[model samples]
Target: MSNTTVKRGEGILSRNRGVLVAFGIIGTWAISLIVLLLIDISQLAIGWRIAATIWQTFLYTGLFITAHDAMHGAIAPSNPKLNQRIGSFALLVYALFDYKKMMRTHWLHHQQPASEVDPDFHNGKFKNFFAWYGYFMFRYWSWVRLFGLMAIYNIISLVLKVPEVNLNWFWVAPAIASSLQLFFFGTYLPHREPEGGYVNENRAQSSNWSVFWSFVTCYHFGYHEEHHEQPNVPWWRLPELHQRKLNAD
Candidate 1:
C-alpha cells in the first residue's frame, strides 16, 4: 500500500509512464484490430495470417495486462477516477468485462490467493490444466458476455462489412488464445500447489525465466511472488524487482 502512494522512485512506476504505456497498448490493440479487419486476408499468404494472429493475440494479452496494472493503482495512483476509467476501457475492449466487478474479484485473489475464498482458486479438484481452465472460465463467464460478443460479431460482420473470416481469425481467435496465455503464465503455473507445499504467505510462485521470456510469456506476470509482495509495481517493473531479489539471494 505504501508503494501505491508514492511517485517515481527505484522500482516505482511513475504516473506518466503508466499512463503512456497503458494508452500505448490500448491504441495498438485498437489500431491493429481495425487494420486486420480492413485488410484482405484472402490476398495474404497463410504464413502472414498466422503471424498476424499471433501478434494480435499478444496485443490482446497486453490489453488485459494494462487493465491489471490499473487495478493496482499503478496507472494513475493519485487520480482514482482516471485509473478506473482507463481500466474500464481496457476491460471493455478486451471482452466486455465489468471493470469494477473484476477489481473486486482481483482484490479477493490477492487477499486470499489459492484459498476457497479466492475467486481465481480451483479448490484443488481441478488440477488438470483443461479442467482448471474450464473452471476459471466458468467462474468469470456471464450470459451477458456471451450475448454481447454475439451482438458485436454480428454488427462487425454485417453493418461494418467485415468478413466473417477476418472476425474469426483476427478478432475472436486471438482473444481466446490470449486468455489461455494469461491464465497459464499469470495464474495456473504460479498458484498451483507444489509437491513440497506452499512456500510463502502469497501462496504463489515465480518462474526462473529470463526477463525476455518473462515478458514474452505474460508481461513479466510470471514473476508472481514479486507481484504479491509489491502489488503496486506495474507489469513492466516486475523483472527489475525480480532480478534484484534474485541477486540478493
Candidate 2:
C-alpha cells in the first residue's frame, strides 16, 4: 500500500469505524442498565433484585471498557480533541481522574511493560501463598486510592456547604468499587503468570481464548503484544493487527 493509502486506513480504524463501534456498544450497555433499573424499581422479588444488582455491576464493567477505549483514542477516531471529549465523559461517568492525564500514563504502559514507568505494574512478589491469595481476593484496594482522591472533592463540597453535594456519593461509591474490580480482574490477574502456567513472550498471548475474552470484556485491550508493537493502531484494530503479525511470522 502507498503512504496515502496506509494513512487513510489508519484514519478509518482510528476515527470512523472504531468510534462508531465503541459508542454503539456503550449506548447499548447504557440502555440495558436503564431497563434493568426500571425493572428493579418495579419491586421485583428478592432473588430477582439480587440478580439485577449483579447485572448492574456487569454494566459497570462495560463502562470501564468504554473509558479504556477513550484512553487509547479509539472511541472517536484520531482527532485528539474528540478523543479527549469522549474520554472526559467516560471519566465523569466511571473514573475519578483527569482523562488526558490518565491517557498519558497509560501510553507509557504501552511503550514499556513491567518497567518502572509502567503505572500498571505491581512488582512485589507475595511472601507466601496466603499473601498471593489475599492480593487476588481483596482486589478492592486498587480503588482505595481513587476513592481517597474523590473524598477530597467531597470534603471540599461539604466544607463549602454545597447543596446536593451528598448526591455524588450515589455514583461515587459504586464507581470506586467497580473500578477496583476491573483493575483486579481485568488487568492484574491477567498480567500475572503463575508458577505452573505457560508464559508467552507476552503473557496476554498465552491463549487465544484469553485474548478473545479480553477483547470482548476489556474493550480489545487483551491484545497487549500488538498494542505494544504498534502503539498508533486503535484498539478496534489491535486484534486484526495481531492476527496479521502472527500470520507474517
Candidate 3:
C-alpha cells in the first residue's frame, strides 16, 4: 500500500460503538455509587463507603476513554465542536486543563515512539546479570512531572471553586493520584519502542498489554503504528486497518 493511500469506511458511530458501550457501563456504575453515597449520608455504613471507593476507581477508567475520544476528535461528530466539548469535558474530569496542548504533545509521542524526544520512552537498561530487573524498575521521570502538573491543576481548581470543576475533595486527591499512576504504569511505561527493535507487522501485537487495555478503555489507541501511519482514519477503524496491514504483509 502506498504511504499516502487513505483507508476509509470507519463511520462515526461505528468507530464510537465501543465508547458508547463504555459510557453505558460507567453511567450504571455512577448511579449505583450515588445511591450508595445517599445511603452513607443517612446511616454511614463502612461497606457502602468501600463500595463507593471501588466505583470511583471505575469512573476514572471511564474518563480515560473520554480523554482518548477527545484527543482523536471523535466525540462531538464534527471537528471544531468535537475538540471543544470533549477537550473541556476531559479537562474537567482529569484536571488536564489544556486538551489542545496535550493533543499537540501527544502527536509528538506518536511521531517518535522510542526516540529521545518521546516523553514516554524508557531509556535505561541493565547489563547481563540484572537486565530484566533494571528494565522493569526503570521509570520515566518526565511522565511523573507531566502528571504532577495535572495534580497541581486539580488542587488549584478545587481551592478556587472554579465553575464546571467538580469540587468533591473526597475523590479529588485519589483521582489525581490514580491519574498519575495510570499515566506511568498504564500508558507510557508499556509503549516504549527500543532502538532498532522489530516493528511488528501486526500493529495490534506490537504494543504491550497495558497499551492493549488502553485501547479497550481509551478507544483504539493501542493501534499506535496505524494511527501514526494514517491519522485521518477514525479511532473505531484503527484495529481494522491494522489487521489489513498485517494481512497484506
Error (Å) of candidate 3 at residue 123 is 5.8
Q: What CA root-mean-square deviation does each model show from the true structure?
A: 5.0, 7.1, 9.2
- Give the per-residue lDDT of model 2 (tens digit) for 1-249: 899999999877654775676576567656755454334243566676555554555556666666677776666654778777766776655545567676777776666555445556553666343454465435324476567666865764567443332223223334545655565555555556567753554444422444567554554556666665665666667778767877898
Off by over 4 Å in 2: 1-15, 38-42, 45-47, 127-181, 193-206, 210-216, 245-249
- Model 3 lDDT per residue over 6-83, tens place: 333345456555456546645664565344333424354657545555556556655655565567665544455645
Error of 1 at 83 (Å): 0.8
Q: Which ten residues in a row have the lowest lDDT in candidate 3?
A: 161-170
lDDT of 1: 0.93
Model 1 shows how many backbone clashes?
0
* Candidate 1 TM-score, true structure as reference: 0.94
lDDT of each structure? 0.93, 0.58, 0.52
Higher TM-score: candidate 2 or 3?
A: 2
Task: State every prediction's TM-score relative to the real structure.
Answer: 0.94, 0.62, 0.54
Give per-residue lDDT, candidate 1, residue 160: 85
